[model samples]
Target: CLTASSNTDGATVVVEPCTTNNAAQTWVQNGQTLLVFGNKCLDVTNGVTNTNGVKMQIWTCTPGQGDAAQHWSITSTKTIQWAGQTECLDLSGGRLTSGNQIQVWLCENGNANQVWNLV
Candidate 1:
């Protein structure tokens, strides 16, 4: 599921499982640019490279041909691989605590948090 929070304060968010009928789950690929229906692009907050459970936020998908941060490849197994990074959309560590954050990390091949369903 892809969830989006308000950009202003990072509050007021909506969460839903990825389903075939949802437009928000639909991702459009124009060459190297990806566009979500709600104009939300995947972002790793603060441009931190290491995992360590940093927050993931949604921002506008910018125009660029080979920006590594914006590049994503959905594997046949539904895991999302961020462009040029070995880390996948990880949910590891634990349930998303109220103040805790999400991050991309090395694929430990576990199911607790590293597993994600890309729509």
Candidate 2:
């Protein structure tokens, strides 16, 4: 689960056990965008380039009005990639425990850290 550090803008996106009725874990997939905190979109920190290990955060959705950092797509191979890019969401250090933050890295087939199952 992509859990928000807090239901606010610029919150870190972490992986945690999914909990019922928890807004932090509730993500709405809008087209190619993953929306949380009602209107916030999962964003790449600093609108950085396709650099490995770039962390993710939540920012207010701007849709067609903002950078591509906030746009994502769950690829056919189950990788959550930055829209129109080859980078996928990678679990920092490949750690699955709670509080492990996610980062953007080059997508790789069969990489468990980049594979995500949307529920």
Candidate 3:
């Protein structure tokens, strides 16, 4: 069960376990399209190419897609890696300060601030 933040600056986003009775947890893949929650699609902001604490958001799934935010590829280890960059989604430098934003940055092993669990 991987939990993604709702936004780089918002609350935690939990990926509920996919159970036989929960279709929302089921991920539908068609080529590059990822059908999340059967409706909402994960997206990044615009097509920005920076890995320094960029914002992440969600929107209605589209056909052709929009930006790198919408482009995510899951690794064999089940880690969610952003497409445009090799950076993995990470917490804000382990500051834990209020309003700390999340960003995609280079994977640095099991850094607590970088280590994320798929719920």
Give lDDT tens digits, candidate 2, residues 5-45: 98778889999988899989888988777888778889999
Provide the overall lDDT of each model, using Cα atoms, as 2-decimal numbers: 0.56, 0.87, 0.54
Per-residue lDDT tens digits of candidate 3, residues 66-119?
A: 344566766665556777576765666666554455566676666566564444
Worst 10 residues of 1 by lDDT: 6-15
Candidates ranked, most accurate by TM-score first: 2, 1, 3
Error (Å) of candidate 2 at residue 16 is: 1.2
Over all chains combined, what TM-score does candidate 3 have?
Answer: 0.56
Q: Estimate each model's TM-score.
A: 0.64, 0.93, 0.56
**Tens digit of lDDT per residue, candidate 1, span 11-105?**
22234444576654465665544555545566666556656555666566655553455566666666666666777666546556443345677
List the RMSD of every prediction in angstroms.
4.1, 1.4, 5.5
